[model samples]
Each structure stands twice: as structure tokens, then as C-alpha cells.
Target chain A: MNTVVRNEKYWLMAAGYIGAIFLWYASVKWLPISSFNRLPDPLSVIREWLSPDPSYGISIFTSDYYVHIWYSTYRAFTAFFLAVLLGVPLGIFMGWNAKFREFSGALVGLLRPIPPLAWVPLAILLFPGVEPAVIFVTFLVAFFATTMNTLVGVRSIDEDYFRAARCLGASRTDILRDVIVPGALPHIFTGLQIAMGAAWFSLVAGEMIAAQYGLGYVIWEAYNLIQYPTIVIGMATLGIVGFLSSAAIRWVGQRLMQWREESLGLGG
Target chain B: MEQVMKRDRGSNNSEGLAPRPEFGKLSIRNAGKTYDPQGSAVVAVHDCSIEIEAGDFVAIVGPSGCGKSTLMNVLAGFDNVTSGEVYLDDSLLASPRQAPSPGADRVVVFQNGALFPWKTVLENVTYGLLKTNAMSRASAEEKAKDFLSRCGGLDKVMRSYPAQLSSGMQRRVEIVRALVNEPRILLLDEPFRAMDTISKTTMHQHLLKMYSTCRRTIVFITHDLEEAIYLSDKVIVMTTRPGTVKLELTVPLPRPRTPEMTASVEYMDLKKEAIESVHEEAKKAFERGERELA
Candidate 1:
């Protein structure tokens, strides 16, 4: 019975995507709007994406397409990796210590509300080059997301766990390792998913504004050159890649948190 | 039954696994706790004093909001008293000036089941022993399995997380986790609250069996009078807000007590005494609530 429901859910999910694609195709082909005519139809975009030797240069078969994908993936991944490395520890300490939280919280409060796109000018000024600037701006958004989520994760842990740990003769280090880290992990992973999305968001914005070799650049370049299908291809690729990256984080989280997954019955 | 008998014999024969030294006499002298010291201070417990001898199972019973939990926190070293002192045998545990740190010697089986959900049942049980460096990893696992099996057969779910177990099983695991550490004093804050009747009964049997084998000091906190009478050597009733001991009743029931004892004349007499004392306090608390509403 459970498997039947799950299979039905999978079918529904597939139908949703297919329905959206059909709607896109219908709107572009049949709509009277001039904007719809200007926009490439879904069929043509898919054809251009799959073509071995495509018009207007970039396609799945072209080296330039992979180059754009690699650059965007590299930038987004580097920022995300750095964010997790720094943000997780900083978040742990922020939640753990009152004095440290007070000191760092002031800077975090000052910076957090500013949109990621707004950081482009300051990032360019702070870093020496476009590559560093784009990466820096992307890193900031993911860092705040990861750090804040991690801090909240640590705080969300029950006081009894701490009491139990201490009563069990756990040292400060042991408490941090055994209680704080594991307890906050669910939230940390939640933060990571958000951080990954934010990283992609800021990376694309940075790429469009400052950098020259990424999927964001491809979309902007295609727009300028009127390669309409390439723009759609860039967007579709970003959506798929962004989803895959977040899925990877979730996959790792599920592996590490088997106790939680099993309890949730996510395995079956 | 054969497994239980063999396990009992095994523990008796092992020198390393023998019961711990009896040094957990807890004495509280005029302990008081007032929350929010700076403004609008609310006294939770006032002039609460009790004496618990080593190897005695003492239960603190009171009406809801009677500061029973506040007193337990002081004994557990989670909070300190605003006045007076709490002593464990010779050493000071808590006071107005001296803050106490929770240690392996005083393990708490929290009412909400504090078994680390991330850890397997075996890991949770072995945690204290590992943390205190009381046993090597191999021996800790061995000892944990031994206690798990003894606690009504928890050995089968050794690899499972706390979330996978029933409330009764989780409660048993928590108790065994505390017992495995060989703490001088085992503090249970309404450890079996909210369990179904059948599970609660089974738990009582397991707890009594463990108590008989180990004979460690236990401080149980509950609002259930009958539970107080059945499980404890002495029941201390606390009055409502700014709570203090209203009455202390001793139970001279024989060891290895059975559920049948709850129906006996002596048990009923003791339960009657506890109920009257608690009812009087509950009436006062209800009146206070009504007055506040007014």
C-alpha cells in the first residue's frame, strides 16, 4: 500500500513537470502576445540544447557550453565549501558562547539584511579581480545562511541533553562533540540546503554583473546577441544543476543521520 | 527467567561489575530557590529540607506546580539553591555561593527520556562509562549489553535509536543507561510519567529488580501518590508554591515488592496518609490559582 502511494507520488511529480513544459510550449506557440513570439518555443530550445553542431555557437555538444557549466559549478561549489567550513564552526561558537555571540552578532546583524546582489560593488573593491569578487559575493550569502542556521540549530537542542551529557561526566569538549554537533546537525543540513541555493543565486548575479565565463554569462550574452534558445538552455541547466547540488547535500545528510532517517521511515 | 537468573549470578561473581560503594547520603538544609533575582523575584522552593540515606529509594510527591521539580534540579546540580546547602555524604553539592557541576556520581534519568536520539541504544547506555573513562570501549560495550539484557531484554534493540523504541522501552533504556554508569545517586524526575498503565507496571517490575540488585541511592520525583507509596522507601510531600515538605511517611514494606502489595492494608494506609497531605496542599494551590485569576 505504501509503495503504491509512493509510486503514485512519483507519477504525479513527473506529470507536474510535463504539464509545465506543455503549458510553456502552448503559450509560446498559440499566445497572441508579441513577447511570446520573441521568446523561443520549448521544442526549439530543447532541439538547440541537444544539437551536435548548433546555430548561435553554444550547445551540449560544444566545448564552450561545458566551459560555462564548469566555471559556474566551480565558483558555486568553492563558495559553498568555504561557507560550510567557516560558517559551521562560527555558528557553533556563536551559539555556545554568550560573549562571542554578542561580539559577532553585531556584525552579522549589520550585514545580513543587505541583499547578495548589493555586495557586488563592495566585493569588487575588497577583492583584486572579477573572479575573486564574484566568488566573495557568492560566499557571503551562503556563509550567513549556514552560520545563522547552525546557530539556531545549536540553540534548538534541548537543555536536558546538555544536563544529561554533563551528568554522564562529559567534558566541555565531549559535550560539544557528542551533544552540540550531533544535536544541531539536522538544522545545519537545513542551513546547507538554503546556503547552496543562496550560493547559486549570488553566483549567477555576480556572474551576470562582473564575470565573463559562466552559465549566468551565457544567459546574458545570449540575451545581448538574441540567441533566445541559448538563454532558455542556460536557465534549464541552472535549475537542474542547482537541484542536483542541493540533492547531494541532502543525500550526505541522510547518510550521516541514519538514526533520524530510520525514525522518519525515509528508507523504505 | 533463566537469562535473568544467570545474569544476576554473573554480576554477583564479577568483582569489577560489583555494586558501587554506598556513599550517596543526600542532605538538604533549608534550600530555597527564587527565580529572576533582579526584578519580580518568584520563589519556587522555600525552606525545603530532606535527608536520604544511602541505598534508600526516596520519592518526592506534591501537587502540580508545587516546586517538586525545582527541588529535584537542585539535587541534580542543574540549579543551585538561593539559600542553604545540599550535601552528598561529606562533600558539598550545591549552595547559594557555590555552583555545582553535574558529574558521573549523580546521574539523572530525566522524565522526557534524555537518551541521545542520534546514538544507538547500546551507545547511549555506554556513554557515561566511556565519558568518565570508567571502562575501556570493549568492556563498556560488554557491560552495556549485560545491563540492557537485564533491563527486561533491551539487548535485541541494542542497535536501534531511542526514537525507534516504545515509551516503555525508552524509559527502561534511560534507567539502564544511568545504572550502567554506577552513579552514587540516581535522580529520576517523574521518570515514568505519561506511560500507559501496562508499560508503567512492567517498568515498575524492572526498576524494582534493578534496585534489588544494585541498592544504589535513588531520588524519585512524582505527583502520583500511589506510585510514591509503591516505589519508595519514604515519601515526602511538598506544599504548593514556595514549597516545603508538608509531610514525610515511611514505608516498611518488604524488599522484592510485588504489585500485589499495592492492594495490601499497609500500602492502602500509607497511600491514604500521602493522599490527605497532598490533597490539602492541592486545595491551597487551587485557591491560589483562583485568587490570581480573580
Candidate 2:
């Protein structure tokens, strides 16, 4: 009964989106709702995206769309990967050790609250290239999100687990491996999803200023050239990419933490 | 059939030849623990002491707020005594400078079992072996499987996580985990408190078998008077609040205590005595709390 309701719910959601698209297409194509008419019609955006570009002679099928996508993807992923690689261990270690927490916590505290976009000027000034600058700004956003969440993950573990490990003759390293890491994994995965979104968010913002080639750069460029349809294309691409990347992270998390999923019946 | 019997005999021989764990006698001398959480002070234990035989099954029963769990925490080395000392034979077990951390030699099977939720039954069982660096992974798995099978749960629960099993089954896995360490002393703090009567009885039987085979000193804490009388060789009753040993009654029932023994006169008498001691302490505890409130 619940599954049936859930299936109906998803169908309703899809219909809602379809209805929204219909409304937008109708409003722009027929109704001259002055303010809404100023925006590009979804149909024109779709056509321009699929058909050859007027200025560059490229479309969704061509390598041109992919090149912009690849630039954004590659930079965002590089930053996110570096964040996870550095952040998870650093977070876990800080969580486990008080001395380390006291030493590094001040710097983390000072930097983390600063908005991802706020660092754009600093990142641009520090790094020589546009690629490195954009990556740096996005990296800070994902890194802070991942690290803080991973730290909270470590702290949230039950005290029973630590005592049990000690009783079982676990050393510091053994407890970290067998208890802390696996215990905090569910939270780490959640952080990764959050971090992925933050990465894309700041990546787009970063590319608006820094990069030569990427979806964000294209959006800025299109806006400057007053290509309304192309602007919509860039935004739609960012939305799709962001949603897919977060979904991918969630999928990997579920796969690795199968025991949790099975217990909660989280899997389909 | 011959091959099976041959393997069994070989295992039996190996078990017999394995060095018996000879843990020193446990002694708690004038131990006291005072809690100073926030500004208020709560004295959980004060001048409480007891001597436990090397292989004896001892049960501590007391009123609520009597610090029974606190005492278990002290013995398990999870908490330090605020004053006095606990000793293993001639050596002091704890120090002011370094709080005594729990060792593999003293395994505690907590009330909740504390089985890692992420680990399978076999993995949880083999965890101690791996942590202690006692055996290679293959040997640990083989040995853990043997213990799990002996508990009659291997085939059904080997791959299951703690969440997938019943509370009773989780407790069995926990027991297997503790036994695998071959600990000298087993501390069970209300381990079967959450189980139904039938499950409790089953656990008591399993525990007895494990005790006889391992010959580890067992200190079990419980609120159930009948359980205390049924299981322990000596049952200690404690006073409430700033708890101290009130009474130590020796149960004279012979080895291999049966459920039928619950109906016996001796069992009833021992139960009556323990109940009487605990009731008085509980009344005192209530009065004490009332006085403080007033």
C-alpha cells in the first residue's frame, strides 16, 4: 500500500514538472505576459541547444557543447576529489585527537564561514591561471563542507563503540580503522553529496570570473552578448549536471553502506 | 561418520592441551567513585570492597541508584575510582596518573550487547582476534566460526548484521566475541535485562555451558532476585546511593544447576534472603532521597 502511494507520488511529481513546462511554453508562445515574455521561450532554448548555434555553428550533438561541459566537469571534479581526499582524513583525525583539534580548529573556524564566492578575488590573486583560480574557489567550498560534516560524523558515533573497541584490545590505529572510519562512513557520504552541490555552485560562480571555457563562462558570455536562449541553455545544463552528480554520490554511498540501507529498507 | 568423529576428537585434544587462562584473584579495596558533574556532587560508590575467587560466578544485586552499573564500569576499566584501589592479585589494577583502560583479559558484555551495527556476526566475532593481533585472518575466521557454530547460531546468523538479528541473538554474538578473547574475567552488566523470560532462561543455560568450558570468573549484575539466586555461587547485595556491600550470601547449590532447582527449598531460601537485604536498602534509598528533597 505504501509502495503504491509512493509510486503515485513520483508520477504526480513528473506530471507537475510536465505541466510546468507546458505552462512556460504556452505563456511564451502565445500569451504576451510582458515580464514573462522578456524571457526566452523553452522551445527556442531547446531548439537552439539541439540545432547548430547561430554564432559558433555548434549544437548539443557537436563537440562544442561537450567541451564547455567537460571544462566545468573536470574542474569541479578535480576540486571535489581533492577535498574528499584531504578533508575526510583530516576531519577524522581532528575528531579523534583533541590536540590536533586545538591546533587546527582556529584556522578552520576562521575560513569556513567565509562564502565560497567571497574567496574568488583571493583565489584569482593567488593562482596565476584561470583554471587554477576557479578550481581553488570551488575547492574551498567543497573542502569545508566535507570536512565539517565528516567531523560531525565522527563526533556523533556512540561512546559504546569506543569502549567496546578498547575492551576488544583495539589500539589507536585499530580503532580508527575498525570503528571510527566505518562508523562515520554514513555521515561522510552525506557530506560528499552536500560538498558536490557546493562544488558545482561555486564552480559556476567561479567560472563567471575566472575560466575561459566552461558552462559558467558560457552563461556569463551569453548574458553579455544578450543571447537569452543560450543563457537558458547554460543554466539548464548546470541544473542537470548538478542533480546528476549529487545523485551519483548518493548511489555510491548507498552501495558502500548496504548494511544501513538494508536495515532501514532504504534500497529499492 | 568416522571422518567427522576424527575431526571432533582432534579438536577435543587440541582444546584439552591449550593452556588454561590463570587469572589472578580480583580484589576491590575501599573503592569509591564520586561524580562532580556540573556543580552538584553525586556519590555513586563509597568504601565498597569485595574479593572474588578466580573462577567463581559472582552476582551483585542492589536497589536502583545503588551504583551497580558504576561498579561494573570501574571493573571494566571504563571509569576510574575516585579513591582507593582495585587489584589483580598483588598488583594494583589502576593508577591516578593513568586511568586503567579495558584490556582483552577482562571482557565486558554490556547490557545492550554493543555489537557493531555495520559488521556481520562472523566479523563481530573475529574482531577481537584481529584487534589483539592474536591470529591470522584465516585462522581467526575459522576459530570465530567454530565458536559461532557452538552457540548454535552460525548457519542462521553468520552473514547477518546486528540490526538483522533478535536482541537475544545479538547477545549470543556478543558472548561469542567475549569468549573468543579467552578473557580471564567476564563482566556481564544486566546482559539479559531486556530479554523475555524464555530468552533469559536460554541465555542462562548457554552462559553456564560457556562458563564450565572456559573456566573464566564471571561477575554478573542484575535486578532480578531469582536470576541472582539461580546463577551465582555468591550473591552480593549493596546499599543505595554511595553504595557499599550490604550482604554476601553464598549459594550452596551443586554444579550443573537446573531450572528445576528454582522450585527447590534452598533456592527459595536464598532468594528470600537476597530480597530481604535488597528491600531494606531500597527503603533507605527512598528515605534518603526524600530527605534531600525536603
Q: Tell me each candidate's RMSD, in Å, in order.
A: 4.8, 6.2
Task: Report the lDDT of model 2 for residue A263.
Answer: 78
Candidate maximizing DockQ: 1
- Model 1, span A1-268: residue lDDT tens: 9799999999999999999999998888888998887888888998999999899888889999999999999999999999999999999999999899999999999999999999899889988989999999999999999999999999999999999999999999999999999999999999999999999998999999998899999999999999999999999999999999999999999999999998887765
Which one wins on lDDT? 1
Model number with the top TM-score:
1
What's the CA error at residue B162 for candidate 2, in Å?
1.7
* lDDT per residue (tens digit) for residues B137-172 in model 2: 999998888888876655468887788777877888
Interface Cα RMSD of candidate 2: 1.0
- Per-residue lDDT of candidate 2, residues A69-141 (tens digit): 9999999999999999999999998899989988999999998999988888888889897889899999998
DockQ list for all candidates: 0.81, 0.59
C-alpha positional error of residue B162 in candidate 1 after TM-score superposition, expressed in Å: 0.7
Which regions of candidate 2 fall more than 4 Å away from where they truly are? A1-10, A30-32, A52-58, B1-24, B35-42, B89-91, B95-99
